[model samples]
Target: MNEIIQLNILQFSLIYLLLILVLILMKKSKISQSKLLLLGTFRMSLQLVLAGFILTAIFENPHPLFTIAYVAAMVIFSITRILRKNPWLNSSFRWSVSLSLTLTGLFILGYFTQIVIGVSLFNPQYTIPLAGMIIGNAMTGITLALKTFHESLTSGRNRMETLLNLGASPKQILLPDVNRALETALLPTMNSMLGMGIIALPGMMTGQILSGTSPSTAILYQIAIMVAITAAVCLAVFCSLHFGYRSLYNQRNQLNLPR
Candidate 1:
């Protein structure tokens, strides 16, 4: 393998400057996301620096157990972050979302590595990054799904109650909002998959090419990763909405309007 190239402080500072300018412009436009932008930049820089050191250590050792532990930590952290962002959500709902994402992400990641990629001993090079991508995508999907479902149920309480009064089952009453929420949650993944190689060269594919992998090999990995992401997103969103419904109704099955 070739030595990794280092980014100079000058280059990093330039990117930060651009981010600040963009955030300022967004604030001027009444976007109200200045804090979010600042937080995101800080978190991104810190996480990447920590991950870089961790990856260096793992690459030196390259043990299968360490690789698995790293991936598991990523999944757990991602799920916890999602839940933390929605503090109004019940604990059970949070657990369901986390369980759903972890199960689906692990299943797809395991299958892709063992069955498709055919890597021996689940190397860190493949497992860690792939698991990161899967967990990240699943996190976004679950967050969107939960937010959308919560908003819809709260806003459409009357409609949902009317449907239930008309003899619709809990499933039937919530079907429309559930489907809409799931679709919205999965939209980003769907758009990226559809627009891959056209609107943007995906980051993974671009990195692979820059690392001197053949275009064909990079494309294969890109396609496989995209498929895995889509599957994980869909499953995560579905499971989130499925389990989230329980929090929307009470013992008498009445819709619980947010106070």
Candidate 2:
């Protein structure tokens, strides 16, 4: 590897030109998402630049507290993002999502950092990146799960009530919806896994290879991280749905879905 070719400011600015293609297509199609596209691009650039500086500092001076704080911040942000994405959920459902994401995210993060990766649990270099990937995927998975669950339940509200009137347990009535949501949540990760080497070069593997890591070693890390991401997604989605559906009812086992 030849010292990791550096991208100068001018060179880096050229990447933004690619967005022009998207803008042209949107304009031709009369899509009104140009503003969102620009805003997303600007925010992504700013956030990644800030993260780069912060990560540099942390990498230079690694500390357990720093890593833990970063992880906690990520969890908080993930919860906030999920709630913002799902404003229609009840307070009880919000609690369920927050708890499920926090618990499952941290649990898997610990396991991956300490056991699977065999790195120091508090090593910022490894833990921060890995936690971002793990928590980020879990957040996306749970968001999709909640969306699917809400849609399915809302559409099938009459059927749910019929089941309840027929003496069906809450579990019995909600199991199908739960399973559907879980499957929806896992599908993206599963599809990506299926197309790993054939259709795409995933971000992690590409980053590692560019940084001069051997292709074989990068492949191993990529595989491990994908598996970890899928596991985290499953656990987070399952926990959210498992506890979330119960929130639809009270002590009397009566359904109280939001109107």
Which candidate achieves the best TM-score against the true structure?
2
Consecutive 10-residue window with the lowest summed lDDT within model 1: 250-259
**Model 1: how far is 117 from its true place, Å?**
0.2
TM-score for each of the candidates: 0.86, 0.97
lDDT of 1 at 65: 87
**Number of backbone collisions per candidate, in order?**
0, 0
Model 2 C-alpha lDDT per residue in residues 1-259, reported as the tens digit of each score: 5678888999999999999999999999999999999999999999999999999998899888999999999999999999999887888889999999999888888898889879888999888998999999999999999889889888999999999999998788989999999999999999999999889989989999998888999999899999999999999999988888888888898988765
* TM-score between candidate 2 and the true structure: 0.97
Q: Enumerate residue pairs that collide in model 1.
A: none
